[model samples]
Target: MISHVLIAIISVLLVAAYLAAVLAGNPVYSALSMGIAFFLTALLFVLLGAPFLAAVQVIIYVGAMLVLFLFIVMMFDLNKSSLTPVRFKPSTILSYFLIMLVLLTGFFVARSVVRMPSGFAITGFGSARNIGFNLMHYYLLPFELASFVLLVGVFGAIAFIKNRRGT
Candidate 1:
């Protein structure tokens, strides 16, 4: 019961942190809030009997990804001249409408997920060795696809930076 309470608290804090990140005016504060959210997410994983996943989440999401984002955001010297707000075009109304609809649908789907009971409490579930084996066997394709996506994203970021600098 205590554990469940703890998990619930962490989950609430995670949501709050995400909201804070979204609503923050300062980029640095947003990144810090996201880091807190990532940490909270790792705690939830640990509470759900996935310590290995928690460690990976901390190391990858918090340690690597968040650190990189923070560095990039910090490196940029923001001022009124460089920090212009984007103007939305009337032609993009359909796109915005579609995105809003998708977000609403996702909210409903996520709401339903809260009531679902976890029945996959088997032994060795979410263990490092188990995950390693599954990665090598059942999830190899998806794993490779994710890696490919990350590689493409890295290239995209590089390209975006070069273009922004008029290189």
Candidate 2:
């Protein structure tokens, strides 16, 4: 009973943090909110009996990624006085509408296709050993592809910096 209540409270906090991240005008506030959201997500993973995932969420996302994001935002030297109010042009409004339409359609389609598993408790489901085995065996290609994508992004960023320096 306590666990369920804790989960519900953490979930509410997670949602609130996410909303704050999305709605915040200042980049720093947005990053901080996102960090809170990530931390709450990690707590949710722990509640679901996935300690490994929770650790990864806290270490990789909240620790590394959010720190990197905050660093980048700080490096940009954004001036609050220079920030202009968002103008919703017709094209922007239409694009947002179209994106929402697609997302809603996808949600409904996915809901029809996917069914929730009956069993909630799965021992060793998120263990490091099990995760390693599955990643190396079942999901090796996707994992490699993701690494390759990150490598490409790093290279692209380096090239962009070099070009900027040259110009």
Collision count for each candidate, in order: 0, 0
Candidate 1 lDDT over 1-167, as tens digits, reads 65677677788888899999999888877999999998889878866878688898999999998999889887877655646577788868889999899868855854564442354333357778778888989999999999999999999988876866477
Candidate 1 backbone collisions, by pair: none
Model 2 over residues 6-37: C-alpha lDDT tens digits?
67878888889989999998898899999989
Ten-residue region with minimum lDDT total, candidate 2: 114-123
Cα deviation at 85, candidate 1, in Å, is 25
Could you tell me the TM-score of candidate 1?
0.65
Residue-level error in angstroms, candidate 2, position 80: 4.6
Stretches off by above 4 angstroms in model 2 are 80-123, 164-167
Clashes of 1: 0
- The collision pairs in model 2 are none
- Estimate the TM-score of every prediction: 0.65, 0.68
Worst 10 residues of 1 by lDDT: 114-123
